[model samples]
Structure formats: C-alpha cells, structure tokens
Target: MNARRGPAWTNSITSTVRRVLAPLAGSGRGIFGTAALLLLLIASGYIGWAKWGDIIVRRPQYVLTADCIEITPQPPWIHSDIKSAVMRDGSLAELSVLDPDLTKRVVQAFELNPWVAEALSAVKRAGKTAPRVTVQLRYREPVIMVRTRDPRWKGDCFWPVDTEGVFLPPEEFSSTQTKAFLRVEAGNSLPAGAVGTSYGDAGVTGAALVAAALKPVWSSMGLEWIIVRQELPNDVGQPMEPTYILLPAGAPVDAVAARRSGRLVSLADPPADEPSLEVRWGHAPGREAPGEASAAEKVARLHQYVAANGRLDQLPPTTVVDLRPGAAGTAVATGRPAQTR
Candidate 1:
C-alpha cells in the first residue's frame, strides 16, 4: 500500500510541470511575430520618404534667359532680327519662369518673325543646369523678286516676294543674293515695312501665277524674266486689260520690231531695247474669271505646244500665243512667218 502511494505522488508532480511550460512557450511566439511586423512597416516608410524628397523637394538646376534661347538653321543675316524680337518685351524674368503658358508665349514671339514661315516649337533641352529654349523655324522662300517704289528708300529697289505675293524684307539680302532670283515687274508699289504683309493687287497676283506655271519648264524655254502690264482702255467705260509677256535674256533689234507689230498691242512706252513675247494671259489663273482658262489648262497647253514646236525662240519673232479659253477652249499660237534677214 505504501509503494502505490509513492507512485501516485510522482505522477501528480509531472502533470503540474507540463501545464505551466505550454502557456509560456505560446506567449513568447506571439510577442516575437508582433515585433517583426512593426519593424517591416518602419523600413518601408523610410524608403518612400527618401524617393519623394529627391523628386519634389530638390532645387532645379536651370533658369530661362536670352542667352539660353537658341534659334537654329537660320542664316546669319537674320540672326539679329530674331534676337531683337525675342528681347523686345525687355523681360528676361518672365521667360525664366518655367511654366507651360510662358513656353507658349515664347513660341508665339518667334512665329511673328517676318522671315519665319512657321515656328515649329519652343522646348526645353534635357539635362541642362538652367533649361535652354530651342526654337525650330521654317523660313519663307523667295519665288520671285520685284522692283517697286518704297517711300522709305531713295528710289525703286528690288525686294523678294513669295508665291502668295507677300513682300519680304530686302535689307537682309546681299546684291549677289538678290540677283539670283527671277526678276518680275509688278508695275505697282507697296508701303514701307510691307515685309509681313500681302498685297491682293490683281497684277501682282497674276504675275505670281504666271511665274509658278512657268517654273517647271523655265530653263528649257530660255526665258529670262516676266512683265505684267495694266493696259488702259482706248475708249471710256471699257474694262482695263492685264497682259503677260515673256522676255528672252537678250533679244535682237529685229525681234523687238517684230513683237511690236504683232497682234497683241505694244506698250506705249516699252522698256527701251528690250524684246518680249506675249502669252496674252488675260487674268490671274485659278481665279475662275468668266471666259478665262484655268492655270493648269494653260500650263498644259503651253507644255504641249513647246514639246511639239521646240522652245519659244524657235517660233517666229512676231508670234503671239493665246492661252485664253476660246470657243473650243484650246490654246492657239499665231504670228507672221519668220522674216528673212
């Protein structure tokens, strides 16, 4: 009976120790998990703060100024004009402020340049300390040069004009540059500073149209220049007439006499010693004036005639080509036989 009691006592001691040890182990595991989760959240927040500080809070490296503005692909002659236009407002501070609206204004200033046909954009260059502005410009091309009287100048001088008859400033061109373009005599004049403006003058517009039509075959035709004349009516209440004439580089005396006697009326005071052929292009082409041929039709007819008959010089000296819309709306060439020398 004593031995049985001793075994029961030992069993009771073992059960008490197991119950106490199990609860202590579970509490230790829960505390460790909670501490690890808090540490992970703290590390994530520190990384996010560092990135935000670098992008938004740092000082910018560059500023806007006249020296920072760059215009490209424009000839040296026009550089002064471009610079003058940019600094006209006298506010470098306004340009330096980096903003979308300010960028748009800068682009507009460049576009207003008389020589610039288009201002593509004004944008900031990447990786610059102070942002530099780059401007892309498309310059206007001169199609024809005209000599007109300007009150600002001493006498009549030549100026370049585009296809739309917009006058370009002559101040920037050298004599060699001026002489390279085909000469056109508009027989009209415009006011001072007409560089950025266009004249809707019928004679000027008509001359431009004729020049464009002749461009493709101009070299082959041995043509030198074009003349636009406004003819007065012989009697009252008659509509004025516009005449188009083509002149060779150097015409002989006989050719001049022959042209004077042709079907087309001669200028009362024709430029002395100059000979020319009359195309009888009555009005500006593409204008769709009644009883007139379209520009394309006239060009096509001229091309076909030249292809069949050779250049204009090969034709009789007195020949007058009529490109107007006739009864059948076809071009016709008429003149007396070539005179024997």
Candidate 2:
C-alpha cells in the first residue's frame, strides 16, 4: 500500500518534531518529551492567533453602523438627512461589512427615500481606521408649484411637484423658498395627492410640462402664472380644448431683478391699476393643434418678440399676445382690469 503524503510544510514540521524529541525518548524521558511537544504546539498556536486572528474573526467593530454609510451631497432643496432617514426607515441601522450583499442592501435602503429618484450605486470603502459605504444617488428636484382651486388649500398656497407631476413634501419649502419656483394655476382641480406621489391630475400634469419649459425664461418674460384653461371665453364659436396661458406680472417692474433679489411682484399689491398682460400660449408641447406651430417654434417666436420689446409685458396691458401659428403675436385687447387673487 502507498503511504499517504501530507503537505510539504506539514511533513517538514513532523520531521523537525521527531528529530527534536528523539533524544528525550532515547534518554528514558518519553513522558516529558510528549508534554514538552504539546507545550510547543500550544505556544505556536497562541502566537499565530495574536498575529493574524483579527483578519480571520468577525467582530462588531468590523460591522457597518448607520454613521458609517455616507451619501453623496444632496441639492439645496433636499432639507432632510437622507442617510439617517433611509437607515431608520429601512431598519438597516446595523449592517455587516463582510456581507456579500452589502452593496445591494445599501442601494435598496436608499431607494426607500421618496426624494431619491434612484440609488445609482453603493461602494464599500474599506478603511483601516474605519470602514464606510458611499452611495451615489439621483434626487427628484421640484420644478414648479401647482395651485389647484381646491378650497382645502388656503390662500395662494401651492404644492411643489417635479416635471412628471410627482408631488414633493410641502413642508420642505418655506414661504420664502416657494417664490423661487414658478406657479401653475390648474383651475378647478382637486388637491394634490400624497407627497412623493404623482399629483394624478391631467391638467396639472400638462401644466407642469409647460411650467418646466417656461422656467428658464419665466422671470425674464415677466411671467407670474401658467394658467391651464379648458376653454377661452373669447372663443365663442370654437370648440373647447385645453390651452395654456402665460400671465405676465401686472406691474412693469424689473422681472429679472425681482426674482434675483428674492422679491415677488404681488398680484394684489400696488400694481392693481395696470391691466394684465397675457401670452396666449395655445397648447402644451406635443398637444398643439394640427395647423398650430410646434412648441419650440412658439417659444422661439416669443423669444424673438421679447428680444425686440424688452419683455413680454412691454406690450400694452389687457393685451393677449397669441403665439399659435396663424395668430402669432397678434395682441387682442381684453378691455378689463387684471384679476387679483
């Protein structure tokens, strides 16, 4: 029968042991030789454990606590501590750094935050002093504030929503912060749904798209509200269809300066005497009438007009500047004072 071969290192150790103990056994000290050999093995094991046992053994120090999870910095609009919120809400206050699925669990936890549109990735950064997991995420930003005619919402109050009409936390914005966003007046609609959910109103959704498109130049255009009108009172013989109107601020104040200085041109303030200026934005993008100009074309035309007239409000008040294909920039006098609400 062939002798079973052990590892080379083990065989070498066995040979060394036999050579060292052979003298004691031959000297009639066999019991002492065995005891000394056992002591040597135990001492070697203790030294080995002291040198490298931490790497082999798991401990609480090696685990990931909530404080060890780092999130990428969020935008100014994000007021809540996303890391704390996610960890507490997800019940992931403690996680094992050695867990094979650590990164996956981290991603899932961050996704639980309503403001987090997507948790892109989580990477475990193994630091000698302390380990940490860094997470990259995409956040949903509020594009516009929508005001429905719902009686439940008091006085000029609005709900902030993203481009897709996803409602954002209202308390996140102070009264001063709200002035930074454009407003959409979705007349005759209900209140917005729960926070972080879609507002679920078609008019509000369409109005949101228009608001987003107008956001860049809204103040420059001296605009205050994007009104979603189902029908125009002036269109007596025409069929009723959804249309958008850009209502410029009543006063001829410096729109750009007002916005930059954090001042709002109050609709009911001293500008009460001036007639309202309305840019008749015919339809929201992609829903234009067959013969009407495309949204891009309309915006270009409006910009051209603004370039020449200084701003949309440069036109006489009580005037409606049509931006559709056929009636482009033809101002119609409404012959009425601006309504203050």
> Which one is best on lDDT?
2
What TM-score fits each model? 0.61, 0.66
Compute the lDDT for candidate 1.
0.61
**303, model 2: CA deviation in Å?**
1.2
Report the C-alpha lDDT of model 2 over 88-117, residue by residue, as the tens digit: 888775666776788899899888677988
RMSD, every candidate, angstroms: 17.3, 12.5
lDDT of each: 0.61, 0.69
Where is model 1 more than 4 Å wrong at Cα?
1-94, 123-125, 132-136, 149-156, 188-192, 231-243, 251-275, 313-316, 326-330, 336-341
Give me the candidate number with maximum TM-score: 2
**Model 2 stretches astray by more than 4 angstroms:** 1-59, 149-154, 231-241, 251-275, 326-341
**What is the overall TM-score of model 2 with all chains considered together?**
0.66
Question: Which residue pairs in candidate 1 have backbone atoms (N, alpha carbon, C) closer than 3 angstroms, thus clashing?
Answer: 61-129, 62-129, 62-130, 63-130
Residue 285 local lDDT, model 2: 79
Q: How far is 61's C-alpha from truth in model 1 (Å)?
A: 6.3
